[model samples]
Target: MAAIRLLSFLDAGPLAYFTPLGAMALFGAAHFSGYVKPYAFPLLALFISDLVLSFTVFAEFRTGLLYSGWYWTYLAFALMTVAGKLMLKEVTISRLIAATITATLIHWLVSDIGACAVENKLTFAFYLNRLVTAIPYELNFLGGTAFFSAIMFGIFELAQRKYASLKPAR
Candidate 1:
Protein backbone atom coordinates (compact mmCIF):
# COMPACT_ATOMS: atom_id res chain seq x y z
CA MET A 1 0.00 0.00 0.00
CA ALA A 2 2.77 2.39 0.85
CA ALA A 3 4.48 1.64 -2.42
CA ILE A 4 1.26 2.22 -4.27
CA ARG A 5 0.86 5.55 -2.55
CA LEU A 6 4.37 6.56 -3.45
CA LEU A 7 3.82 5.66 -7.06
CA SER A 8 0.63 7.65 -7.06
CA PHE A 9 2.71 10.74 -6.48
CA LEU A 10 3.96 10.38 -10.01
CA ASP A 11 0.59 11.47 -11.32
CA ALA A 12 -1.17 14.11 -9.31
CA GLY A 13 -3.73 14.87 -11.95
CA PRO A 14 -7.26 13.58 -12.11
CA LEU A 15 -6.30 10.55 -10.01
CA ALA A 16 -4.57 12.46 -7.28
CA TYR A 17 -7.08 11.44 -4.65
CA PHE A 18 -7.24 7.82 -5.71
CA THR A 19 -5.42 5.85 -3.03
CA PRO A 20 -5.23 2.42 -1.46
CA LEU A 21 -4.89 3.70 2.09
CA GLY A 22 -8.59 3.35 2.71
CA ALA A 23 -8.60 -0.22 1.50
CA MET A 24 -5.48 -0.92 3.48
CA ALA A 25 -7.13 0.26 6.66
CA LEU A 26 -10.18 -1.81 5.92
CA PHE A 27 -8.08 -4.85 5.09
CA GLY A 28 -6.16 -4.54 8.31
CA ALA A 29 -9.32 -4.06 10.32
CA ALA A 30 -11.00 -7.11 8.85
CA HIS A 31 -8.03 -9.47 8.92
CA PHE A 32 -6.24 -8.68 12.15
CA SER A 33 -7.75 -10.03 15.37
CA GLY A 34 -6.20 -7.65 17.87
CA TYR A 35 -6.71 -3.93 18.36
CA VAL A 36 -3.12 -2.76 17.92
CA LYS A 37 -2.15 -4.67 14.81
CA PRO A 38 -5.10 -3.48 12.80
CA TYR A 39 -4.82 0.21 13.54
CA ALA A 40 -1.14 0.40 14.30
CA PHE A 41 0.15 -1.24 11.15
CA PRO A 42 -2.13 0.58 8.74
CA LEU A 43 -1.72 3.96 10.34
CA LEU A 44 2.00 3.44 10.47
CA ALA A 45 2.03 2.68 6.78
CA LEU A 46 0.06 5.85 6.12
CA PHE A 47 2.39 7.90 8.27
CA ILE A 48 5.44 6.54 6.54
CA SER A 49 3.94 7.21 3.15
CA ASP A 50 3.05 10.71 4.20
CA LEU A 51 6.56 11.26 5.43
CA VAL A 52 7.96 10.24 2.08
CA LEU A 53 5.49 12.30 0.13
CA SER A 54 6.25 15.26 2.35
CA PHE A 55 9.86 15.23 1.26
CA THR A 56 9.41 14.26 -2.36
CA VAL A 57 6.17 15.14 -4.06
CA PHE A 58 4.88 17.53 -1.43
CA ALA A 59 7.99 19.32 -0.36
CA GLU A 60 6.52 22.72 -1.08
CA PHE A 61 3.50 21.93 1.05
CA ARG A 62 5.32 20.35 3.95
CA THR A 63 5.05 22.15 7.24
CA GLY A 64 6.52 19.98 9.98
CA LEU A 65 6.54 16.22 9.83
CA LEU A 66 3.81 16.38 7.19
CA TYR A 67 1.57 18.82 5.41
CA SER A 68 -1.15 20.85 7.04
CA GLY A 69 -4.43 19.14 7.91
CA TRP A 70 -2.65 15.78 8.00
CA TYR A 71 -4.49 14.66 11.09
CA TRP A 72 -7.80 14.72 9.34
CA THR A 73 -6.64 12.16 6.77
CA TYR A 74 -5.40 9.91 9.51
CA LEU A 75 -8.61 10.38 11.42
CA ALA A 76 -10.55 9.38 8.36
CA PHE A 77 -8.51 6.19 8.03
CA ALA A 78 -9.02 5.37 11.68
CA LEU A 79 -12.74 5.81 11.35
CA MET A 80 -12.73 3.73 8.21
CA THR A 81 -10.96 1.01 10.12
CA VAL A 82 -13.69 1.16 12.70
CA ALA A 83 -16.26 0.93 9.97
CA GLY A 84 -14.52 -2.15 8.61
CA LYS A 85 -14.47 -3.75 12.04
CA LEU A 86 -18.15 -3.16 12.39
CA MET A 87 -19.32 -3.91 8.86
CA LEU A 88 -16.90 -6.56 7.61
CA LYS A 89 -17.08 -9.34 10.13
CA GLU A 90 -18.07 -11.56 7.23
CA VAL A 91 -16.68 -10.01 4.10
CA THR A 92 -18.96 -10.25 1.09
CA ILE A 93 -19.60 -8.34 -2.09
CA SER A 94 -22.37 -6.26 -0.62
CA ARG A 95 -20.59 -5.63 2.66
CA LEU A 96 -17.45 -4.58 0.82
CA ILE A 97 -19.39 -2.18 -1.38
CA ALA A 98 -21.09 -0.63 1.62
CA ALA A 99 -17.81 -0.34 3.49
CA THR A 100 -16.17 1.34 0.49
CA ILE A 101 -18.93 3.91 0.28
CA THR A 102 -18.79 4.48 4.00
CA ALA A 103 -15.04 4.93 3.93
CA THR A 104 -15.21 7.35 0.97
CA LEU A 105 -17.87 9.47 2.62
CA ILE A 106 -15.97 9.45 5.87
CA HIS A 107 -12.80 10.62 4.17
CA TRP A 108 -14.57 13.35 2.22
CA LEU A 109 -16.39 14.76 5.21
CA VAL A 110 -13.53 14.61 7.65
CA SER A 111 -10.84 15.93 5.31
CA ASP A 112 -12.96 18.71 3.84
CA ILE A 113 -14.17 19.79 7.26
CA GLY A 114 -10.63 19.75 8.50
CA ALA A 115 -9.51 21.85 5.55
CA CYS A 116 -12.20 24.39 6.31
CA ALA A 117 -11.24 24.41 9.96
CA VAL A 118 -7.60 24.90 9.16
CA GLU A 119 -8.44 27.76 6.85
CA ASN A 120 -10.70 29.19 9.59
CA LYS A 121 -13.52 29.53 7.14
CA LEU A 122 -16.61 29.10 9.26
CA THR A 123 -19.19 30.09 6.70
CA PHE A 124 -21.82 28.15 4.83
CA ALA A 125 -20.68 29.38 1.43
CA PHE A 126 -17.11 28.38 1.98
CA TYR A 127 -18.11 24.94 3.20
CA LEU A 128 -20.47 24.45 0.30
CA ASN A 129 -17.87 25.47 -2.27
CA ARG A 130 -15.26 23.24 -0.73
CA LEU A 131 -17.56 20.26 -0.93
CA VAL A 132 -18.72 21.11 -4.42
CA THR A 133 -15.18 21.37 -5.73
CA ALA A 134 -14.16 18.12 -4.08
CA ILE A 135 -16.65 15.91 -5.86
CA PRO A 136 -14.30 14.87 -8.66
CA TYR A 137 -11.50 13.91 -6.32
CA GLU A 138 -13.91 12.06 -4.10
CA LEU A 139 -15.20 10.10 -7.06
CA ASN A 140 -11.67 9.02 -7.87
CA PHE A 141 -11.13 8.13 -4.26
CA LEU A 142 -14.26 6.04 -4.33
CA GLY A 143 -13.03 4.15 -7.36
CA GLY A 144 -9.64 3.49 -5.80
CA THR A 145 -11.15 2.27 -2.56
CA ALA A 146 -13.55 -0.10 -4.28
CA PHE A 147 -10.98 -1.37 -6.75
CA PHE A 148 -8.33 -2.04 -4.14
CA SER A 149 -10.79 -3.48 -1.65
CA ALA A 150 -11.99 -6.04 -4.14
CA ILE A 151 -8.46 -7.01 -5.13
CA MET A 152 -7.13 -7.31 -1.60
CA PHE A 153 -10.16 -9.08 -0.14
CA GLY A 154 -10.56 -11.37 -3.11
CA ILE A 155 -6.92 -12.41 -3.11
CA PHE A 156 -6.86 -13.02 0.64
CA GLU A 157 -10.06 -15.02 0.52
CA LEU A 158 -8.79 -17.13 -2.32
CA ALA A 159 -5.49 -17.71 -0.59
CA GLN A 160 -7.18 -18.74 2.63
CA ARG A 161 -9.30 -21.22 0.78
CA LYS A 162 -6.35 -22.70 -1.02
CA TYR A 163 -4.08 -22.82 2.00
CA ALA A 164 -5.82 -23.91 5.13
CA SER A 165 -3.01 -22.52 7.27
CA LEU A 166 -3.72 -19.08 5.92
CA LYS A 167 -7.13 -19.11 7.55
CA PRO A 168 -7.33 -17.61 11.00
CA ALA A 169 -7.88 -20.05 13.83
CA ARG A 170 -11.39 -20.04 15.18
Candidate 2:
Protein backbone atom coordinates (compact mmCIF):
# COMPACT_ATOMS: atom_id res chain seq x y z
CA MET A 1 0.00 0.00 0.00
CA ALA A 2 2.83 2.38 0.82
CA ALA A 3 4.55 1.53 -2.43
CA ILE A 4 1.34 2.08 -4.33
CA ARG A 5 0.89 5.51 -2.70
CA LEU A 6 4.46 6.46 -3.58
CA LEU A 7 3.62 5.80 -7.20
CA SER A 8 1.24 8.78 -7.02
CA PHE A 9 4.28 10.94 -7.73
CA LEU A 10 4.09 9.75 -11.30
CA ASP A 11 0.73 11.46 -11.79
CA ALA A 12 -0.62 14.41 -9.84
CA GLY A 13 -3.81 14.46 -11.81
CA PRO A 14 -7.14 12.97 -10.78
CA LEU A 15 -5.52 9.58 -10.95
CA ALA A 16 -3.29 10.67 -8.12
CA TYR A 17 -6.19 10.04 -5.77
CA PHE A 18 -6.40 6.46 -6.90
CA THR A 19 -4.64 4.61 -4.08
CA PRO A 20 -4.83 1.47 -1.98
CA LEU A 21 -4.88 3.32 1.33
CA GLY A 22 -8.61 2.94 2.00
CA ALA A 23 -8.42 -0.72 1.14
CA MET A 24 -5.33 -1.18 3.28
CA ALA A 25 -7.07 0.27 6.29
CA LEU A 26 -10.12 -1.86 5.66
CA PHE A 27 -8.09 -5.00 5.08
CA GLY A 28 -6.11 -4.48 8.24
CA ALA A 29 -9.22 -3.96 10.29
CA ALA A 30 -10.95 -7.04 8.88
CA HIS A 31 -8.09 -9.53 9.08
CA PHE A 32 -5.49 -8.44 11.61
CA SER A 33 -6.03 -9.21 15.28
CA GLY A 34 -5.16 -6.90 18.20
CA TYR A 35 -5.29 -3.14 18.36
CA VAL A 36 -1.75 -2.54 17.13
CA LYS A 37 -1.84 -4.78 14.09
CA PRO A 38 -5.08 -3.41 12.73
CA TYR A 39 -4.60 0.29 13.40
CA ALA A 40 -1.01 1.18 14.26
CA PHE A 41 0.62 -0.64 11.37
CA PRO A 42 -1.58 0.86 8.69
CA LEU A 43 -1.28 4.32 10.21
CA LEU A 44 2.47 3.91 10.42
CA ALA A 45 2.63 2.83 6.81
CA LEU A 46 0.59 5.91 5.85
CA PHE A 47 2.92 8.19 7.80
CA ILE A 48 6.03 6.65 6.30
CA SER A 49 4.61 6.95 2.81
CA ASP A 50 3.66 10.57 3.50
CA LEU A 51 7.14 11.27 4.80
CA VAL A 52 8.64 10.01 1.55
CA LEU A 53 6.20 11.98 -0.54
CA SER A 54 6.89 15.12 1.47
CA PHE A 55 10.57 14.96 0.58
CA THR A 56 10.27 13.76 -3.00
CA VAL A 57 7.04 14.59 -4.78
CA PHE A 58 5.73 17.36 -2.57
CA ALA A 59 8.88 19.07 -1.44
CA GLU A 60 7.61 22.46 -2.43
CA PHE A 61 4.53 21.97 -0.29
CA ARG A 62 6.38 20.58 2.68
CA THR A 63 6.63 22.56 5.89
CA GLY A 64 8.20 19.96 8.17
CA LEU A 65 8.44 16.21 8.66
CA LEU A 66 4.98 16.09 7.13
CA TYR A 67 2.89 18.49 5.18
CA SER A 68 0.41 20.76 6.92
CA GLY A 69 -2.99 19.26 7.72
CA TRP A 70 -1.54 15.76 7.86
CA TYR A 71 -3.66 14.95 10.86
CA TRP A 72 -6.84 15.22 8.82
CA THR A 73 -5.76 12.45 6.51
CA TYR A 74 -4.80 10.26 9.43
CA LEU A 75 -8.11 10.92 11.12
CA ALA A 76 -9.98 9.88 8.00
CA PHE A 77 -7.88 6.74 7.71
CA ALA A 78 -8.57 5.81 11.30
CA LEU A 79 -12.24 6.32 10.77
CA MET A 80 -12.11 4.08 7.73
CA THR A 81 -10.47 1.39 9.81
CA VAL A 82 -13.23 1.73 12.35
CA ALA A 83 -15.78 1.50 9.58
CA GLY A 84 -14.24 -1.73 8.38
CA LYS A 85 -14.24 -3.20 11.85
CA LEU A 86 -17.91 -2.37 12.27
CA MET A 87 -19.02 -3.31 8.77
CA LEU A 88 -16.96 -6.34 7.80
CA LYS A 89 -17.19 -8.95 10.51
CA GLU A 90 -18.13 -11.58 7.93
CA VAL A 91 -16.25 -10.19 4.88
CA THR A 92 -18.45 -10.87 1.92
CA ILE A 93 -18.56 -9.24 -1.52
CA SER A 94 -21.45 -6.98 -0.56
CA ARG A 95 -19.82 -6.03 2.72
CA LEU A 96 -16.57 -5.19 0.98
CA ILE A 97 -18.34 -2.96 -1.49
CA ALA A 98 -20.32 -1.21 1.22
CA ALA A 99 -17.24 -0.68 3.38
CA THR A 100 -15.23 0.69 0.49
CA ILE A 101 -17.98 3.15 -0.33
CA THR A 102 -18.17 4.21 3.29
CA ALA A 103 -14.42 4.64 3.44
CA THR A 104 -14.33 6.75 0.30
CA LEU A 105 -17.07 9.03 1.55
CA ILE A 106 -15.39 9.33 4.91
CA HIS A 107 -12.10 10.31 3.29
CA TRP A 108 -13.75 12.82 1.02
CA LEU A 109 -15.71 14.52 3.75
CA VAL A 110 -12.97 14.65 6.35
CA SER A 111 -10.14 15.68 4.04
CA ASP A 112 -12.16 18.26 2.20
CA ILE A 113 -13.39 19.75 5.43
CA GLY A 114 -9.81 19.91 6.59
CA ALA A 115 -8.78 21.59 3.39
CA CYS A 116 -11.43 24.21 3.90
CA ALA A 117 -10.43 24.78 7.48
CA VAL A 118 -6.75 24.99 6.63
CA GLU A 119 -7.41 27.48 3.88
CA ASN A 120 -9.55 29.51 6.29
CA LYS A 121 -12.45 29.44 3.90
CA LEU A 122 -14.78 27.45 6.02
CA THR A 123 -17.93 28.99 4.68
CA PHE A 124 -20.80 26.81 3.57
CA ALA A 125 -20.46 27.93 -0.02
CA PHE A 126 -16.78 27.15 -0.21
CA TYR A 127 -17.27 23.79 1.46
CA LEU A 128 -20.06 22.88 -0.88
CA ASN A 129 -18.02 23.92 -3.90
CA ARG A 130 -15.07 21.87 -2.75
CA LEU A 131 -17.27 18.83 -2.29
CA VAL A 132 -18.83 19.29 -5.68
CA THR A 133 -15.54 19.64 -7.50
CA ALA A 134 -13.96 16.70 -5.73
CA ILE A 135 -16.46 14.13 -6.94
CA PRO A 136 -14.24 12.74 -9.67
CA TYR A 137 -11.28 12.24 -7.40
CA GLU A 138 -13.50 10.53 -4.84
CA LEU A 139 -14.87 8.24 -7.53
CA ASN A 140 -11.32 7.22 -8.38
CA PHE A 141 -10.73 6.64 -4.72
CA LEU A 142 -13.78 4.40 -4.56
CA GLY A 143 -12.58 2.44 -7.55
CA GLY A 144 -9.13 1.94 -6.09
CA THR A 145 -10.51 0.86 -2.76
CA ALA A 146 -12.84 -1.67 -4.36
CA PHE A 147 -10.19 -3.00 -6.72
CA PHE A 148 -7.52 -3.52 -4.06
CA SER A 149 -9.97 -4.86 -1.47
CA ALA A 150 -11.15 -7.52 -3.90
CA ILE A 151 -7.63 -8.55 -4.80
CA MET A 152 -6.41 -8.72 -1.21
CA PHE A 153 -9.47 -10.48 0.16
CA GLY A 154 -9.74 -12.87 -2.76
CA ILE A 155 -6.11 -13.94 -2.51
CA PHE A 156 -6.36 -14.46 1.21
CA GLU A 157 -9.56 -16.48 0.85
CA LEU A 158 -7.90 -18.70 -1.73
CA ALA A 159 -4.84 -19.16 0.40
CA GLN A 160 -6.94 -20.07 3.40
CA ARG A 161 -8.78 -22.67 1.36
CA LYS A 162 -5.53 -24.26 0.20
CA TYR A 163 -3.77 -24.07 3.57
CA ALA A 164 -5.82 -24.77 6.67
CA SER A 165 -3.20 -23.04 8.80
CA LEU A 166 -3.95 -19.78 7.02
CA LYS A 167 -7.47 -19.69 8.40
CA PRO A 168 -8.02 -17.74 11.55
CA ALA A 169 -8.45 -19.82 14.68
CA ARG A 170 -11.97 -19.76 16.06
TM-score of every candidate: 0.93, 0.94
Model 2 stretches astray by more than 4 angstroms: none
Instruction: Tell me the deviation in Å of residue 60 in model 1.
Output: 2.4
Per-residue lDDT of model 2, residues 82-150, tens digit only: 999999988999999999999999999999998898789999999999999989889988988888888
What is the alpha-carbon RMSD of candidate 1 to the true structure? Answer: 1.4
Give me the runs in candidate 1 sitting further than 4 Å from their true place. none
Cα lDDT tens digits for candidate 1, 60-88: 88899899889988898899999999999
- C-alpha root-mean-square deviation, each candidate: 1.4, 1.3
**lDDT: worst 10-residue window of model 1:** 8-17
lDDT score for residue 25 of model 1:
83
Clashing pairs in model 2?
none
* C-alpha-based local distance difference test score of model 1: 0.87
Question: How many clashes (backbone atoms < 3 Å, residues ≥3 apart in a chain or on different chains) does model 2 have?
Answer: 0
**Which candidate's TM-score is highest?**
2
